[model samples]
Target: MTTDLEFVDTQVHYWQPSANDWYPTLRSRPALYRDILPGDFPPVAGHVHVSAVTAPRAFLDETRWLDRMRHDTGLPTAIVGTIDPAASFEMIEADLLAQAESPAFRGIRVFSGLDPAADTTLELFRLLAEHDWIFDLIARLADVASYLPVIEKSPGTTFVLEHAGWPDGEEPGQFRQWREGIARLAAFENIDCKISGLGMALGTMDPQRLRPWVETCLELFGVDRCFFGSNFPVDSVAGTYAELITAYREITAPLSEGDRHKVFAANARRRYRLPG
Candidate 1:
C-alpha cells in the first residue's frame, strides 16, 4: 500500500500538566497524559499541531511551551498557536509577529465556538492579514452565520474552518444549516475547510458514522480547498489514530489519487508553508 504519498497530520495537539486542570478526565488517566510526541505519530513525513482550548489567556505561554517541547522531543512539524480574538489588534499582531520567529509556529487559531459573536474577532482577522498568518476558525455550524460577516470583512486573510464548521448532529435541519452555511462561506476565496474533528464533535466512537459530514465537507470545500487532519487527543476520545486515518481514507476514496494527496499532505504543506 506504500505509494510515494507522504502524510502530514495537520491537526493534532500535545498536552502538558498545565492543561490537566482544564481536562480533569484526561488528567486522571496517566496513559492518556503522555504528551503526543513525534514518536507517537504514524510514520509520516511531518505533522502540524493546533493549540488545545485550555488556558485561553496564556496563548503566548502555551506557544513557548510547545516550541520547547518541539525542540526537546522533536514533535510537530509546525504549530497553529492560539490567540484570543477578543484582544486588541495591536496586541494580537505583536504576539503573532513574535510567534512567527519560531520555526514551528505556522498560524493562529481563534475558537469561534466559544463566543460566536465576539466583537473583537473582526480585529483578530485584520491582525492575521497584517502578519500574513493563517487563521484557524473553530466555530459550530450554527455559529457559521455569525462568522460570515467577519469572514467577509477579512477577505485577504487565509481562513481554515475547522470541523466542517463543527456541524451539529444528524438532525436534518442542523445538517441543512451546516451545508448552506458552508456553501455561503465557500464563496469567500480566503476560506478553506479541514475535514477533521467530526467524530469528536459528533461524540461518536464510530468513524463510519461521520461519513455524511465528511462527504458534505469534500463536496463544499473540494479537494484543493480542503485538507485532512487527525485532531488527535481530542479525536482519540472517539477512535484510535489508525482508525481516524482509515476513516479519512474511506471517505475520500472517491477522489482521484492527486486529490487524495492534496487532502493528506499537499494542501497542508501549502497552507502552512511546510517544506517539501
Candidate 2:
C-alpha cells in the first residue's frame, strides 16, 4: 500500500503565547484538537506552518513562535509568515531579511479578505517580488476578484491562493463567481491554490460535503498547481487532524499516485523550496 507519494500538509496553524488562546475558540467545539501535533500526521514527510490572524502587531511574534515550534516539533519544513503589505517596503525588506536566516521562512501572508483595497497589499506584493518570496493570499470569496491586478503586476512572484480563494456556500452563483475568478487568476501561471478551509467555510465538519469545491479546485488548478492543507486548529472548529487528512485523501482519490504526491507534498516542496 506504500505509494511513492510524499505527504505534506501545506496549511496548519498554531497559537502563540501572546495571542489570546484562539486555538480554544475552535477546540471548544467537540471532536477537534484531540491529540494533534506535527507527529500526528500519519506518515507525513513534512508540513508548512501558516500564520494565524492574531493582533496585527503579533505577526512577527507568530513567526518567532513557529520558528521555536519547528525546532520543538520538528515537522514544519516551511513557514509562511505574516506581514503588513501597507508598511514601507524598506521596513518589510528589513524584517524579511532578518528572518531569512531561519530555514523554515519560505514566504509571506497577507490577510487580503480583511481589506483587499488597502494600499499595503500592493506594497506587500511588490516587496514579495523583490525578495523572491511566495505570497500566501488569504482572501474572502468576494475579495478574490480584487487581487487579480496585484497578481498580474507581480508576474515574477509566486502566489498561493489560500482555501481555493475561500469560496462560500454551494450556491450556484457563488460557485460560478469563485470558478470564474479562480480561472482568471490561474491564467497568471504564477498563482496556485490550496484545498484548505473547506469545513470552516461550510460550517460543517463533513468532508463529503466539501467534495464539489475541492473537485472544482483540482480541475481548475490541476494537481501540480494545487496543495493539501489541514487548516488545523482553526479548522479544528470543524474536524480533527485525522478527520481533515481523511477528507483530503477522499477528495483526491481519483488522481494518480504521482498527482496525489504532488498535491500532498511535491508541489508545496517545490513552491516553497522546502527541504525534501
Candidate 3:
C-alpha cells in the first residue's frame, strides 16, 4: 500500500507531560499523556509514509519553548505557535519575534474568539500578514462566519482551518451545520482546510463514516487548498497514528495521483512554507 508521495503531518503533537498547560488535561488520559517526542515516530510503514510534520500548538504562549522542540527527533517541519490576541502589541511582537528565531516556527494557531469586527482580531491578522505567518485556527464552527470579514481584510494572510473546524455532536443537524460553516469559510481563497482531528469528534477512525466530511473538504477547497494532518497523540484516542494515516489513504484512494499528492503532502508543504 506504500506510495512514493512524501508526507508532511500538519497537525502532529509532541510534548512532555511536564508541560503544565497540557498535562492537566492529558493526565486523565495516560495513554496519550505520556511523553511523545519525535523519536517515538517510526518511519514509513505500508502507505503511511511521513517525511516531515507540522506541529500544532499545545500550551498557549509557549512559542519559544515549542520552537526549541524542532531539535528533538521527529518534530514537525514547521511549528504552529499560539498567540494571545488579547495581549498588548508589545507583548505579541516580542513573542512573535522570538518565535520567528526558530526555523521551525511557521505560523500561529489561535483558539480565541475571532470577532472579525474586533480591532484586536484585525490587528492580529495584520501582524500575521506582515510577517507572512499563517493563522491556524482551531475554532468553534459557530465562529466561522465571524472570520469571513477578517479573511477578506487580510488577503495577504493565510488561514488553515484545524480539524475540519472540529465538527462534532451525534445529531445529523450538527454535521449539516458544520458543512455549511465549512462551505462559507472555504469560499474565502485565503482559507485552507486540514483534514484531521475528526477522531476527537467521533471517537473512532472509521473511514467510511469520515469519507463524506473528507470528501466535502476536498470538493470545497480543492486539492490545492486542502491538506491532511495526523493530529497525532491527541487523535491517538480514536486509533493509532498509523491507523489514522491508513484511513486517510484508503478514503482518498479513488482520487487522481496528482490530487492525492496535494492532499497528503504538497498542500501542507506549500501552506506551511516548508522546504524541500
Candidate 4:
C-alpha cells in the first residue's frame, strides 16, 4: 500500500452459517455461499460489516455476533447493523436498543423495496436521526430517483447509498439511468456513496474498464463523499478480494494523498464515527 494507506475497509461481510441459515438467497451465488471471515481479508486498520440478512429477531443477534467477533478477533472497528423498516416501530426500537448496547454499533442499513416517499420510510429516517446513527440506503438503480424527495426532506439524517445505488448493469440505458439517479442523490449534503458491491452486476474486474464507474462517482460525489468498501466474499464475484483492492487503488491513484486517504479510510471514520 502507498503512504496514507486507507486501512479501514468500510464494507466487509463475515459470512457465517450455512446458506440456509445465513441467507438462503445467497445459495444462488456460490462464491458467497461459504464462510467469509475477517481473516479472509488483507490486513486493514478497521472494517465495517454491513448486515446481509435482516430478519427481525436475527437482526440484533447478528450485530451481537459481529460485536463478539470484533472483541475476539479485533477487526471491523465499527458495525453497521440492520433493521426491518417494515417491522413495527416498537419491535424495531427494541432491536435497535439491543444493538446499541454494543460499542461497535454505528447504525442500520435497510434494503430495497422501501418506498422512498412513503410515510413509513420518512419516519424511519427520523428514527435514525434521533440516534444520530448512519442510515445505509439500498435501492435499485432504476428506482433511485424515486428517493430524491424523501432524502431531501430528511436533511438531518446521514444517508449512505449502498453499491452505487445498486446499478443492475452498465449498459447504455442502465448507465444513463444510474448516473442520473446517483447525481440527483449526490445533490444532498446528507448523503454519502458507499462505493462497494458493484461486482455483483459488472462483468470485468479490470481497473481501466471499471475506472469509468468509479470516476463518475468521484466526479459526482467528490472523494470526500466516496469511500472503498470491498463488500468482501459477496463482491468477490467481481474479482478476488486482492484484485478488487488493486483495482480501486489503480483507479484512485490520480487523487492527491489526502483525498486518496479519505476515499480509503478517513471519510468512513468521520461518517461512521469511528475512533482514530
lDDT (C-alpha, whole model) for all candidates: 0.75, 0.73, 0.72, 0.80
Q: List the residue pairs that clash in candidate 4.
A: none
Q: Pick the candidate with the highest TM-score.
A: 4
TM-score of each: 0.86, 0.84, 0.87, 0.93
- Candidate RMSDs in Å, in order, are 3.0, 3.4, 4.3, 2.0
Residue 267 in candidate 4 has what lDDT?
92
Clash pairs, model 1 backbone: none
Name the lDDT value of residue 189 in candidate 4: 89
Give stretches of model 2 more than 4 Å off. Answer: 1-5, 16-43, 112-120
User: Residues 226-269, candidate 2, lDDT per residue (tens digit)?
Assistant: 98887876676776667777777777788888888888888888
lDDT of 1 by residue, 43-72 (tens): 776778887745556667767777887788
Give the per-residue Cα lDDT of candidate 4 at 185: 86
Candidate 4 residue lDDT tens string, 82-170: 77767777777877889999998988887645667778778878888999988888867667668777887899999998887777776
Which whole-number lDDT from 0 to 100 does residue 38 have in model 2? Answer: 64
Error of 4 at 152 (Å): 1.5
Residues 159-208, candidate 3, lDDT per residue (tens digit)? 88888888866478988898888988888888899888888888888888
- Say which prediction, candidate 1 or candidate 3, comes out ahead on lDDT: 1
Best by lDDT: 4
* Residue 262, model 2: Cα distance from true site in angstroms: 1.2
Candidate 1 wrong stretches, greater than 4 Å:
1-5, 18-34, 112-119, 205-207
